[model samples]
Target: MAIVGGGPAGATLARLLAKDYKVLVIDKRRLDSDPQKGQFTKCCGGLIAPDAQKMLAKMGLALPQNVLVSPQIFAVRTIDINNKLERFYQRFYFNMDREKFDRWLISLLPDEVDLRCGSQFKHFEQEEDAVRIVLTQNNKTHIEHAKILVGADGAHSLVRKQLGIRGLVPREYISVQAKFTAKEIMPYFTAIFDKEITDYYSWIIPKEQHLLLGTALKPRENVSSKFELLQEKMKRYGIKLNKQVEKEGAFILRPMRVRQLSVGQSPIALIGEAGGWISPSSAEGLSYAFRSASYLAQAIKSDFKNYHKHYLDNITPLRRNIRLKNLKAPFMYNSQMRKWVMLSGLQSMQIDEN
Candidate 1:
């Protein structure tokens, strides 16, 4: 089996399949002796809900205590256009060091899984029984023949493009994430919502010795300016911009068709954001990525006819509900729809709105 993109999805899948099949995981980034070097510029603010934690624990992985940014987040605050704030108490939440977490996850993979980093994919040619892949690594080009090919290459997936799968219709939403190391503040996860301004929210996640502060907005809007606006908002909320750590941006795809995970092409599958498993509302990819990886692993193991439904089951409902709610937001604005959304998330996730 050939797995492209050795991030969370590819690493997890490679680990799972290595038990039964020979798996090769390839990635473009150089694999340094230092695990932290594998950490790419991820847009996630590193907030993993309890359910996701449970899944990771099942995989014999636990969030390293030292990397734990925040454990007990009991409050969630949402700020509106007029600077009106509604705060709720969250029951549970976890803030983590994304780089550390990813490295930790990748470390769990078995040595039998041929993990190749700094390998660039050239293209692929389909044969009778397998697909022939052309890749370049260490300044040398090579060919990899696999019975199955899995694309976990993320949003701009080269595998998806090579397979002639149309990209998901670009949505109007985009997220800009910035990580900062500063003194902890407020001891909770907070999201400030202002529709009139950005049509999205600002987040403050307090971590160990630092805080992950970010803002997500519609893609059509000027994101650079929006980041400045978010910084000002953070200042208003009493968050001091002390030290800059890292900054990254991502585009969010809404409720759109995922052409990657089709069963039409036998022995080929797509997983993670490359498969369009991101939540349309929150753009949360970790949970969905985990879910998709597990499902795909199972389908590959079992006698499954339609894997698309299994993959869609993890995200379609949430995506549909979010789209419907967004459509009604114009009418529901005065009814505290934004506040309700935040509260509902806290309730469903069993986390306090801080």
Candidate 2:
């Protein structure tokens, strides 16, 4: 089997399945190298949800010190657009380098797993018994045959398009994240919600050396103008934007229909952002990405015929919760009381409770 991504979802799945099957993982970026690690992933920085942490721990995967770039987060500060309501509390959350996290996961793969770093999946041709996969590395083309091809690539995945899997790919938005050099990177995490952006939220996560600021907005919004507003907003917290270091962003997908999970009997599976597993409201995709990869790995090994069933079963509840949150997003943006309710949820995430 060949997996066409080496992100959290793809790498995790490849690692899991490599024990029972011959797996070849392909990625456009070189995972073994680190000169430009973070630049390749283009993630929203490191904010692993509680469920995600539990899942990883259950898998016997402990995060090493080298992967972490910040102290354990004890609290977070959340605010509305106008700065009228600010809520702060000591909760349980942590931060890491997204690319380093990816690198670490990829590095953990057993040597039996064939890791094609810097190799791009050009396309695949489905034969009767197997699929002929095509890839290009260092301008040289190659082909490999595999019974399954998993698309763990992010939104706008080439695998997703080639398979003719449509529906619900419409609700995609742009998430722009940039790095900045600053004197003080806050210990606590900061999240902001603005009606002006209206669809998704923004965040400020502090690494040991840099400040990571990002926003997910509708394609119609002026991305540059939103960055300006974000800068002004950060000033309220005493975070002055310093020399900009680097920037990375991508389109995140939120599927609109169950048909989006419609993968026919073909030897294919779209699991991560490619499968529209991201949150509709928050744009957080990691938890779902990890979970979906696990489920897809199961389907690939045992119930290949029922792949679509497994896919639907895994994502049905997620989509429902996403819809509920999307419904509540506007209220949280428009009403102070509602924003309090939102903050209250975060406030209630006490360490002991967790």
Candidate 3:
């Protein structure tokens, strides 16, 4: 079997099925030895939410101390820009370095699995009994054959596109994040709902010594202008973003419908964001990635020939979770509804004013 991504989903699948099947995992990033050498990092909040923590615990995995960053979050400061409302919500999240976290997961992979770093998946072709995949590395091309192919390559999955399936359309956004040095560490994550900047949302995450400001903006729009405006808004909120250390961006897919999710067909399968399993409300994907990979592993272990059927059946709860999130999205995105909720102080942390 071959997996085209080395993120959480692919890594988990490879690790689980390595002993049984000859698994091969390919990733474009150099995550093996010196991951920092490339200076490439995924644009993410690097937050391990409660659900994701539960998933890790279920897998019998313990997060190493080195993978964790300082200022463990205990609450979320949600700011509604238009309504001029601010509230703190009790939520626990583990803040860590995304690259380091991924590296740690990759390190856990058994020697039985063949891991390839800095290798780009060109494409794949499914024949009678096996699937042939083309990979490029250092301007060289190579082909490999596998009985099963999985695409856990995330939102912009070329493998999913190659399947020629016009899956349900999900709302897409261009996510841009800037890392800035922080004078003082923040104890909580900040969630911004500023319709002026994005109908989606913006966020401020603290990573030890640096603070990350990111927002999801519509594609083909003036993203730079919107991001600048967001920064200005932050300044007005008494939060001044200092000198930017780095900037990154990526495509974000928010699935609003359960039908958007897919585990793929027989020979070809998908997982994680590639299969549209991300949370529509919070855009949380780690839990979905881990859970999907686990289900896929179970299916392969039970009956490899009926992997897709078993996977689809196993992920019914995940799909139902998506539906529940969809039901809650309006209470978040709708300004009037959100305003009422904030005013009601429902589940909001109370801070006494002296």
TM-score of 2: 0.87
Select the stronger candidate by TM-score from 2 and 3. 3
Q: Weakest 10 consecutive residues, lDDT, candidate 3? A: 33-42
TM-score result, candidate 1: 0.80
Global lDDT of each candidate? 0.67, 0.75, 0.90
Residue-level lDDT of model 2, residues 1-354, one tens digit each, is: 899999988998998898889999999988888846344665666887676787788778888888787756877777666545566666666577777888899989999999999899999999998889999999999999998788888887888888875544647677788888868657677778776654557888887778888887677778888877777767765777788898877887755444454333457877778777766655667877787888777666667666667766665666676667667665555566556576567543433422
Model 1 agreement with the true structure over 73-157: per-residue lDDT tens digits: 7556555544354545444667777766666667778888888877888888889878899999889999999987888887667
Between candidates 2 and 3, which one is better according to lDDT? 3
Question: C-alpha displacement of 354 in model 3, angstroms?
Answer: 9.3
Best by lDDT: 3
Q: Model 1 misses residue 167 by how many Å?
A: 4.8
Candidate 2, lDDT over the whole model: 0.75
Over the full model, what C-alpha lDDT does candidate 3 score relative to the true structure? 0.90
**Candidate 3 clashing pairs, residues 3+ apart or interchain:** none
Model 3, position 68, has a per-residue lDDT of: 95
